[model samples]
Target: MSANLESVTDTADLAQSLREVFGRAQRALREQSGRFGLTPSQAEALGYVLRDGPLTITALAKRQSVRSQSMGATVGVLLEQELVTVTPDPSDGRQKVVTVTEKARALVAKGRNARTDWFAKQLDTLSPGELRTLAEAQKLLGRIFP
Candidate 1:
């Protein structure tokens, strides 16, 4: 609570720590999707498609901040793997809509379950005081993020 906010080193160290922890946590969760033979980009694209119902490659690319060609390649792999299907967009015949198949949904669900179970197991090991501290820290983070 007495930390110096004006110090450049303090800010840099805090930023580095946040990035390292977040990156590690994300990598661990992403590992759950590895068993399905999906690359990170493919997994991400499928997640967006699954969550948003259907989307065009341009939409996906824009959401992901990638070039359309890159998203198209990812979509191609998804189509070849039968994880997604593409059909003419009802609103725009010139555009194609990408949709997740049942297989992709099941895969995403299983991966999510795995990540949840893994994190829950980790959390279970925390002491009551530690858990409370983590909750307080999360609230502080929410203030910064939200």
Candidate 2:
């Protein structure tokens, strides 16, 4: 194989490794979110509402990358659980805007704190150099998506 071709292959392998690591991290977070009494989809929906405030059902569906019907089911469940509420949209009277409730916000905050605590404990076990490397990798990952 040519030297340049080998280098490209090596880079692809490294990117795959990074992708796997990210997937694992996401899985871990999802598992932890379940412990906080939320399904992965529900937690993700709450996260969007928290970040973006109230949104029409169609808008929330788009943000969650789910079909409107699927998002409607999720929103129904959240409403039943009292984690979210709907208000009539001012701009569009026919549409209802979904917003996270205070209870949902508290639940999300607790879940985040739990995940951060777990990550912090794990980071403490790593060597300082390892921690620094992780910090740099985080910055690199940000750039990769951005």
Candidate 3:
């Protein structure tokens, strides 16, 4: 790329673009998640549990970037729904670890499958060159964040 082109790509510009794209993609995915009977927060919390396995309420709150009280409320709802369960934390007697139950796993899998199917359909509509461009963009996005 030319020096002029590089100069035009300021950090602010890149950050804004990343934020916009991420927001749009999340909104789209959340719509699909809703169809599977989950709110955005519920889906996000489930994903955190699925990816990180069992975690304490405080840890999950931190991972979700929300206050502990907020996370407690979310967890409470999840527990009431039987989507998650609390187990004794082996390392900390006072702390309980929250994990996805089989029901939550099934729900998450179904929701993820729905989102993937939607993306797959969209990808199918793209030309080979366009798909290649998206693949390259994915790499670029990873590099930008890293």
Candidate 4:
């Protein structure tokens, strides 16, 4: 409660800690996603679609920070796998929107469940204080992200 923001030193340690935590989370996701035979980017794109609903290729590209052409290719794979379908936009006939299919939803849900289960198992190893700290960290992360 007595902490001060002024006169702060270099934040290399804080930055490195964040990087390591993120790396571990990414690795965990990779293990779950690997079972589905998707590249990280593809998995990410599918998850994004799951969370955000249908989007056009250009919108997906912008969200994923990739080029439109690259996003188009990714969408092609999703389409070929029958994970998503492209339909004419009701408001704009010239544009097509990509939507997730039941199969894709199932895949995403399975990955999420697996990760949740794995993490839950790991959480059992932590003490009450550590669990409290982690709960606080989750809240802090939500604030930082949102």
In order, the Cα lDDT scores of the candidates are: 0.90, 0.84, 0.83, 0.83
* Range of the 10 consecutive residues with the lowest summed lDDT in candidate 2: 29-38
Output the number of the lDDT-best candidate. 1
TM-scores, all candidates, are: 0.79, 0.83, 0.74, 0.77
What is the C-alpha lDDT profile of model 2 across 54-91, one tens digit per residue? 88888988987899889889888889999999888999
**Quick one: best TM-score, which candidate?**
2
> Candidate 4, clashing residue pairs?
none
Residue-level lDDT for 20 in candidate 4: 100
Between candidates 2 and 3, the one scoring higher on lDDT is: 2
Off by over 4 Å in 2: 64-70
Ranking by TM-score: 2, 1, 4, 3
- Residue 115 alpha-carbon offset, candidate 3, angstroms: 0.8
lDDT of 3: 0.83
Task: Please give the distance, in angstroms, between residue 37's alpha carbon in candidate 3 and its true position after superposition.
Answer: 4.2
lDDT of 3 at 86: 86
